[model samples]
Target: MNPTATALRAGVRRGVIELRQSLTNGADLWNHAFWPVLMLVVTYFLRDVSFGRTGFTVGALALPGILGMNAAMAMVTMSQLLTADREDGTLLRAKATPNGMLGYLVGKIVHVSGGLVVDLAIFLVPGLFLVPGLVTGSPDAWLTLAWVLALGMVAALPVGAVLGSVFSSARAQGLLMLPILGMIAISGIFYPVTALPGWVQWVAQVFPVYWLGLGMRSALLPDAAAAVEIGESWRHLETVGVLTAWAVLGLVLAPIVLRRMARRESGSSVARRREKSLQRAGM
Candidate 1:
């Protein structure tokens, strides 16, 4: 067998093990359920409220956007896990093995993407019941949903890996939440972006979050719903173009960044980081 092929198989096994551990562990299971449940509760309350004269409830309109936002958030999950792994010397251990970085990255992608699919199912299955006006019966709708999700992950995860490599510490990774939250606020996740100021709309369009939301809305909503969007269309081409650009950028950058970060990992450095963390915890 080819060395890379061997590493790939090991990576797949690593990812499956990690994903199973997450599903079976109490804390991880809670983490998976918490956000979706909270979002469902919020949507339930808003389900009765109308979105202007569009005849769609606020909750219905928000559901697909919420799904997209959560899918895009897989990037954050990948980033945080990468940082945690580095802090705990997992990266260092991988570096010591043959083609370990390749295996490690493949494993990370599989786990993160797999976990994302689970999270989406958690939200979408109940969401269909709780929210109205979603076109669930069409083959086209599902096809749209499938591509948006696949591309969205491709765009997000590599960028997330790059971010994780850059942050260097758990504390630093936490700071990333603020900007992400800010982006969500402007990304039309909870409301129509056309309603926001022109500058805000432009800023929102610059990122993947808005496009993801738009893509989801395109997938799940009625044709009339496009009237509420900018340009009165789904703009599928733009969505594909923007997300593909990000995917390319991230794919190009992640390896360079990860390799650089991995080069700096050593037994002494890992031990020092562990010592510092223990000291901070007063343990």
Candidate 2:
């Protein structure tokens, strides 16, 4: 039997176990339910609020955009888990074993992706009932959703891995959130990007978050809703191209970055980290 293959199988099992634990854990279950429920409530209140008399409710518009943002957030979640693991010596231990880092990477992806799917369903199923003016019946709607989600995960998770490898601690990782929030502000997660300044639109275009939101809107909104988007079009080709580019970049960088980060960590460093953590807790 191939050793790497065996490692991968172990990863799969580990990821499945962790995913199940997330489902059962009280804190995890609350986290899983909270955002989606909040969004559902918002969607319900805004269900009748029209977007510029176009007959499309703001609620409907927000649904897919929120979905996109949630999908893109997989990157952040991956980074969070990775950084936490490193701080706790998981990364160092994984490095000591043959193919352990590979397995660890695979496991994290599985856990993140699976959790994302479940969260998406939690928001979307109820959202569909509250938000109307969507192109729900079209076969193209679902196909677009499927491919956008697939590309989104590929584009996001590996970049997250790279980020996790770079940030030294949870405090350092928190800095990443400032830029992320700025991106979300301009990325049209809750409103039309077309309403923002043209230069701002250009800035948003450079990131995957904008494209992810665009892709989701394209999937769920009616064709006429494209008028509300920049370029007055869905720009599916551009979305695919940009996300694919990001996917390629992330895939190329994650392994090299992970290897570098792992090589830099020693048992003593990990022990020091644990000691600091204990000291902080005692304080």
Report model 1's TM-score to 2 decimal places: 0.99
- Assess every candidate by TM-score: 0.99, 0.97
Candidate 1 residue-wise lDDT, 1-283, digit = tens: 7999999999999999999999999999999999988998898888899989988788988999999999889999999999999999999999999999999999999999989899889889998988878899999999999999999999999999999999888878889999999999999999999889999999999999999999999999999999999999999999999999999999999999999999999989889988999999999
Q: Across residues 1-283, which tens digit of lDDT does each residue of candidate 2 receive?
A: 9989988998898899999999999999999999889978987888788889777888888889999999999999999999999998999888988899999999999999999999999999978877878788989999999999999999999999999988878768889999999999999888888889999999999999999999999999988899888888999999999999999999999999999999999988888877887887895
Q: Give the count of colliding residue pairs in each prediction.
A: 0, 0
- Score each candidate by Cα lDDT: 0.94, 0.92
RMSD (Å) per prediction: 0.8, 1.2
The lowest-lDDT stretch of 10 consecutive residues in candidate 2 is 53-62
Top-lDDT candidate index: 1
Model 2 scores a C-alpha lDDT of 0.92
